[model samples]
Every structure is written in C-alpha cells, then in structure tokens.
Target: LALRSLAFQMSPQELDLGPEKVPGPVWGALFETHDAGAPFSLLVLHDGTAHLYLSTGGGLIGSHGLSEVSQASQRFMTQANRLHHQARPSQDHPLPAAGMSSFYFLTYQGVLCYTAPEARLGDGHDQLSPLFHLARGVVAALESAHHHQSRHTPPAR
Candidate 1:
C-alpha cells in the first residue's frame, strides 16, 4: 500500500530496490526528503518500529508511529527483510558524517554499512522512501543526518 501510494504519487521508476551488500540482519535504516523547506523523515527499526516525522525547517510539526505488530510495521519489516535476503547490500564501516551523505546500514552484528550518495534512491535527487514504525529519537537522528547530508552535498554543477 505504501509502495502503491508512492508509485502513484511519483512514477514506479522513482522507486528502486537493490541487494544489500554483506546481507544479514539489519538494525535499521533511515530515509529522508525535503520539500519547500519542510523536512520529512522515516526511520525503521529492526524490531518493526516505524517513526514518521514532519518538521518545518528544522522545527517539529508532528510525529507519528506504527506499533511493531501493526500491518504497516509488518510491511516495513517485510521490505527490510527482503533487502536482507535478496539485495544483501555490502556492509561498510560507519564513517563520520563529515564529508558527504552516505547510506548507513547498521546490522544486528553492530556493523555499519555506509554507501555514498545513498544508492537506495537511485541517484540521490530530492525524494523520500517509505518505511514502518519506530521512535522519535531515532527519527530525529535520521532527520539530523538528512539535514547534515543535504547541507554537506555540493550542489550539482
């Protein structure tokens, strides 16, 4: 349903799914997007917690969550599990969020997989990916990361 809604809002082409390198159990993943200065973020915890946040230029608008057993949360788990099984994205060591925006995939083993320009969205254009329920702190961390990534990325020439 989330995927369908996203596909409807944008084109199906906007959605891309690939294998995770060194695939295994994931701790969680964060996705972010900005529109007209409004920052939106989705954080999915491995336990099936999904946190959704909408903030106004770094200010909080509202936060919502779906419980682990909820259908939405289950759907998110399914998606992450799919990535774990099929794509198995390479696990990279977590680096400082200093230079660029890289996709960070933290595994259950405490491994952090970092990929530059976060290939999950194809070619890092402005956009949002979908996920299930989680926590505010987690979401905030993700939003902060997104903001950091956005601020750090050198604008296209």
Candidate 2:
C-alpha cells in the first residue's frame, strides 16, 4: 500500500462529491490533515458512511450504525453545519500543504472550504477545532473496529 498508489482515493472528487453535485443543506464533510509527512483524510457523510484514507496506504470504508463511529460522525456533522456559514465557497479542490489542514463541507448550495495551520486546529485555537476533534474520534472508532476485526478473523491461507 504505497502512498502514491492511494493518492486518487484522497480527494473530494474521487469520493463522488463536488460543489456542482451536492444540493440543499450541509450533508457531509471531508477533513484533511497535511502536516504528517503524508496527507490523511476522513470523509464523513450524514448517513453514517465514513471513509478514512491513511498516509500509509489502503483505507477503511464502513457504514456506522449504532456504533461509536456513528456517534462521532453525527457530532462532527452537527458542528460542521453550524460552522459552514463561516466557510467560503470553494472554487477549486486543493490539498493543503504541510503544516496545514483543510475542511470541505458539502452543502446544497455548494462546497465550502476552510483551511488553517494544523497546530491551530489541533490546539483548539480555531473555531473549527471542535470539528477537528470530533473527526479524530471518528478515526479512533474506525481504527478500533479494524483492530477488533483483524484480531478475530482467521489469517489468509
């Protein structure tokens, strides 16, 4: 799972989402952190469909039901919608540079974007810090589920 091989999976367009396609209110968010040598992304939709693309390659795609992932996804969306107005309409889909983070909100009107230094977002110094924290929770829950599944499943022959 080389990082380059998974590059296509890390963008908003690859997820079948864009400003022109989505309509109405905020329905989902794509949060990306770029300071960690390689980019990492979390795409969380209103229906509890979450996909995490790691810098190490490969990724996780799941529909969370009554799990912790679902709860975290819900909370992330709530804050995303509440803060969407503060984001500007995105003219292009661009990945953040190192030491930065980007948040793209899919709304009925169109996609909106907010970008800031990773430290600012992670340290609760930005207004969107809560969303960043909630996204982390979703990532944690996804990782937990993956770990549990791996431990219980039989190895490939």
Candidate 3:
C-alpha cells in the first residue's frame, strides 16, 4: 500500500448525494427501490480523489475490495444492529454521530475507513487534515489544483 501524508487544501465539487446514483452496470443494482431510501450510498470522484456518502437510517458499509469489504461490513453491520437495539425515540440525536448510529466504512485510496455522520462531524474548518487523511489522495489532488493557474473549483456552501 502507498502511504502518503495528506496535506494542503483546495476547494472541491460538492457531492450529490441525491439518491442511489452510483454509475456502471455492475454498480447500478446497488440501488434497489427504497420506499424511504434507508440503505444507500453516494460515490463521488474528482480527478484522482474520491469519497463516498452513505445514506441510511442504519447503514454501515464499505468497499475495500470485495473480500475485505465483505469481512468489514459484517462487523460494521453488527455494530449498527446493536445500536438499533438500543434506540429510543427522542429529539436528542435521533442518530449517533460516531462509533455507532449511522456510520460508513469506506476505503478511499485503499485506506480502510469508518466515518461518523457528516452532519454531526462538526464543521469542516478544523477537519481538513482528518478529511484529507480519510481520503488519502484528496489533499494532494486538491493542493495540485490550488497551485494551478486555471480555474479552481469553488468550495461548498
């Protein structure tokens, strides 16, 4: 595995997590009809960088090669199931932000990841390093873009 330090920051295109919109024939079926769209994911790629957005009331998923992904998903799902068991209706944190509740296990540039909810991950201001670390190639890619004399992508609002 290529170990690279994630540094530098550049604006990126926003991830369109509208629905189960993964591309390619093999990946298309990942989108099954969901009355409420409980378990789904969004895969966004720009240049050589990539990130995945999981949309599930209780989904914990990963795709780090099929075999490793399969192994990881079972453990992640087990944790999700445990959280489901302890769930109670309340206005406070309808979903947990980390460790449990709705989390995603993604391998960005081969780095195995378990992510907490985006909404509760706090603002991205203090998150550049961690975010780049999570998606190993992002910092380098973004930094390259930052150095370019051409148009740079705008940051998300």
Write the residue-wise lDDT of candidate 3 on 57-134 in tens digits.
322222333333333333333333233222222222122323222222221111122334343333343222233223
Off by over 4 Å in 1: 1-24, 55-69, 84-103, 110-157
Q: What TM-score does candidate 3 reach?
A: 0.22
C-alpha local distance difference test of each model: 0.39, 0.75, 0.26
Better model by lDDT: candidate 2 vs candidate 3: 2
**For this target, which candidate reaches the highest TM-score against the unseen true structure?**
2
Each model's TM-score? 0.36, 0.80, 0.22
How many residue pairs clash (N, CA or C atoms closer than 3 angstroms) in each of the candidate models, in the order given?
14, 2, 0
Task: Evaluate model 3: give its lDDT.
Answer: 0.26
Considering only N, C-alpha and C atoms within 3 Å, which residue pairs clash in candidate 3? none
lDDT of 2 by residue, 1-157 (tens): 2432243334435656454554426777888886359888888876566778776766786645637778778788888878888789986767788998888887765678999988998999999888888888888888888788789999899
**lDDT tens readout by residue for model 1, 132-152:** 122223454445544665798
Error of 1 at 48 (Å): 2.6
Top candidate when judged by lDDT against the true structure: 2
